[model samples]
Target: MKLLKEMIHPELATRTGRILRRHAARGIVLREQDQILLLFTERYNDFSLPGGGIGEDEDMELALVRELEEETGARDIQVKAHWGYIEEYRPYWKPDYDLMHMTSHFFVCDIAPELAEVRMESYEVANGMRPVWVSIKAALDHNLQVMSRQEETMGLSIQRETFILEKISREIIF
Candidate 1:
């Protein structure tokens, strides 16, 4: 896939002495007419695409399929196109690491007519995360609103999600 964007967090611009943990994640764009598949996290009061971390050595396609299933209960997923990837450098906040470099790959996909049950992780559950079919504009607007407030409830991935939502709205959904 091609590189879409590289976002270096403003806070990390002057920081140093940090260990790097490179993470690879995948997300999908599953659209039905005017609606798109998204994960709404009540805790963050924001929306994001349905996907998550890719395990070590996992195939990108496999990870996309697995993440769609795990996060949105999406079935019959067909990754139609490689949308591209976004790279982010942000605070890691772990004992051994102070920065994280993440590469998030995105795809344009098609899924079954009906969704099954979401198998969200424990943290997702605690955050009140649920699958929702919403317009790309809605997701983008809502995330931009949350980011403007810069609240404590905001999640780490919100910026990336908002950026992707904007890109999708412009490049695909519009």
Candidate 2:
């Protein structure tokens, strides 16, 4: 999230001007044996990556680890590489409020294949955040819906599903 505060829109003075502080978030594009980790969020019942907003002044790397643990209970993750960033301009949802811009930091992580036997948090489980492994290509081909247009842009644009698929092709034994 620290990386996001550095990005600015041409029109607005800054996120500070709107009284909305910057939020940093991290998502690990977990891959194993040619399969990408995905979650079927109960809220909208859609498949998406695992991540959440970073608290004020929170360390993004720490936040990423915490979010991954909270959402999927996967430990001992090895961050393989950084996939860079994506920016979106809108509140996560609830269109009535002032729009927010989010900068998402994405990383490619390696997780134990056995962690697929997940322990979903009750909060998230109640809301439908279930772990699923899908082929990199399959995840891209599905009718994926991010929380919002901005969120979709923030997630999908970082690696673009095509690029991720290519990388997955060489790394995992599909």
Candidate 1: count of backbone clashes, pairs at least 3 residues apart or interchain: 0
Whole-structure CA lDDT of model 1: 0.82
lDDT of 1 by residue, 1-174 (tens): 699999888778544667574545455655567688888999989998887777788887898898899988889888888888888888877878778888888888888978899888899999999998898877888899888989888978888889888878777766
The regions of model 1 sitting more than 4 angstroms off are 14-18
Highest-scoring model, lDDT: 1
Clashes of each: 0, 2
lDDT of 1 at 3: 94
Question: Relative to the unseen true structure, what is the C-alpha lDDT of residue 133 in candidate 1, on a scale of 0 to 100?
Answer: 89
In candidate 1, how many Å is residue 74 off? 0.5
- RMSD (CA, Å), each prediction: 1.7, 6.2
